[model samples]
Target chain A: DVKDCIIAYFRRSLQQGGGALSGKRALVTAGPTHEPMDPVRYIANRSSGQQGYAIANALADLGAEVTLISGPTTLRKPAGVAVQDCETALEMQALVAAMPVQDVAVCTAAVADWRPAQIVGQKIKKQSRDDVPAPLELVPNPDILADISAPSPSRPQLVIGFAAETENVEAHARAKRLRKGCDWIVANDVGENSDVMGGRENQITLITEQASEQWPRLDKNDVAQRLAALISERLSGKIDL
Target chain B: DVKDCIIAYFRRSLQQGGGALSGKRALVTAGPTHEPMDPVRYIANRSSGQQGYAIANALADLGAEVTLISGPTTLRKPAGVAVQDCETALEMQALVAAMPVQDVAVCTAAVADWRPAQIVGQKIKKQSRDDVPAPLELVPNPDILADISAPSPSRPQLVIGFAAETENVEAHARAKRLRKGCDWIVANDVGENSDVMGGRENQITLITEQASEQWPRLDKNDVAQRLAALISERLSGKIDL
Candidate 1:
């Protein structure tokens, strides 16, 4: 009778710790990577890192251990979550590779596709109106999403990537999901008229192997909460990836 | 006797309004220009706008009518100063041309020397690792410093430009002062080791037609105050420009 009472007490304590994501681990990437052209100049994007930070907080609220790897952003670090900052795509790639495998991985950083071929040691001088500088030589940066989503023993159970498209949002995202070998892809329109990038609100379509569902425009925090809930259900075997 | 008393009262009020910079109009440019490659991406620099903002505040404290033209930066606007924001170097150029002639103009912004030849309408899609993109094309941007320094009827009485140099600081700054036809050039080292670019402390060399003097490392605010004093001296005919 004493042994039975101890077992019941432990079970109740575990349930009280958290609901669905009690034992889950998550890795999240946010913000925009800067590709250095020189000591002073750089190529960068406009990712605010708000959504990624919100998602990390949401998952942690559900008792998931979340680690956020971010590029340069002014956002404050989320409470109860670990955060690491990186400047370039290559730096982020190395950190991601070194991290331990997790139950879920969310890739939301707008990594630069190309970087200057070489970083000039000195500031390039502008001679005169007659003198024109040569065109900028560029080379492709590493594809982090594809590398992480590749099927391997070390790969996470669920890998999700964000697709910022200016046109043909859903079709491009579906193709990207299959191409990157990720479980799901979140697609959003960032057309000239869409106030999505750096904005507070987001309208997204979550594309999965089963179906694609468009969500209404909502605050970035709400989007993060909704996505985190779905992740918990899927990880708990209540729904498919 | 009554008229003389009224004139004396007016003179006292004028003296109380401010010290050396009283009744002067100044235009200051700060921050780093962003040259857009596309809607989401741009070319930028490491300017924090601290030094320029400090200069604006210092000038205003001495009762100068200050108007600040700035690029993108996270720094808050200084009190008692008019601020106009711009993105690219071209846009800043247009705004500068539109402003009324000022008594003094300080060019401190690290404006981009070049911008993308064309801004892409849509985000450039990253296809695969093998799909290499072409090199980026760049075009020369209008030289605002040289334009403002050239002799003109509406030119400011005093024009000061900032020179960010790594080596031969004095020589480069002197050369810049002569080439741009500016009254003075504030030169600072932004070498790999120097922490002056975005740091609170700064070491500067003031280059003028008469002499070149290097000051010890001090807070950016102190540099602004010292420079403002010199500007007042020059404007009041106490010192040579």
Candidate 2:
């Protein structure tokens, strides 16, 4: 249904000289991954799925067959997109591993870094006022971006990750790209009261291999359009490869 | 009044930390510059003064005499900090130059790279839809990070710049640090979803001469606290010139 809406939009765009994304296959991950502590509790971030939803809409506008692996969110299903729902980081990883090869993969989900060492079948009761601060052991989660970008048989042609920052925006983002082994890292300043998340407008700096282009903050939809256009251009440029 | 507020906060932090940021003077630039297309139609970015404002608050909490040069925003003035307001990049440059020599400087503002070649006194009227787009010529603006990091009487002991990227996050951030002659760069991703802008939470990576540290997504206040702590620690670690 979402895919149909996107295709309808794309057909109209194609009429206006926008090229087709007929053969491209794209994957996107959105929202925050849950690291369950028990049957009733979990660790997660504040991702509302706005970014991922907008990207799916934008990619559909460009004619890409997009599959969105989304965590829990209330965002409307974008037109002309396929969505695979998952609850935990592990579940999301399994879904990614199971998917057929894709041309591009964008990991936008803010995956929890750690999970409880063991899942408790029942919810632990809070006993005394000082319940000894139950020591919850943590284990590291898989790096989805790095996994998708690795030289595997199903490695995506292009991989992108998000580096949201409040303080050291660029330095940290760059290191993340290197550590995660992704092709692109979109950096933003998420300091107090920033409008990028669950907000309507955004200003972004596009850091590519060759240049860093800064665009004025515009409506999120406009940003998506510009990004789609840029990606489409890059994809076309790489056709000979 | 804001200066007093910041100073008071710094005093309290000094009482807690004992010796960190004891004698350091830190300067910060915040907000966006407006490039005049005409008196009525000026170009500006959507910088909400959150990141810089939070930084000011955090720095004050770390026992530093903070000088904050801010662009237009409606945020409450942080207590115990000195602030200068400016509307243009050039004004920001002059203010930064006039400030007392500082131990560290963080250029967090989304400073405009280009300003209108000429600030037209009167607004230009749109002739017709058929008329070719009006060419508003642009002129380069000074690179604040580059200018401050260069050898000069007012050069800071340590300079930091924010690198916001959409692709190749680490490579571009590293290159930017080198190009700008800054000691540190905070690289972050402002992916298509705008996770980092005008949001209350942020995730960041810190890049320095030592190594890169990836911080999980955290509240803006926590980020400010951590960054301030790190800056204070590092400044103390350095040998006095």
Specify the highest-lDDT model's number.
1
DockQ of candidate 1, scored on C-alphas against the true complex (2 decimals)? 0.56
Per-candidate Cα lDDT values, in order, are 0.88, 0.71
Which candidate gets the maximum DockQ versus the true structure? 1
lDDT at A129, model 1 = 55
Residues B15-79, candidate 1, lDDT per residue (tens digit)?
35756887888999999999998889999998889999999878876778789999998897776
- DockQ of candidate 2 (2 decimals): 0.01
Lowest summed lDDT window (length 10), candidate 2 chain A: A124-133
DockQ of each: 0.56, 0.01
The positional error of residue B4 in candidate 1, measured at the CA in angstroms, is 38
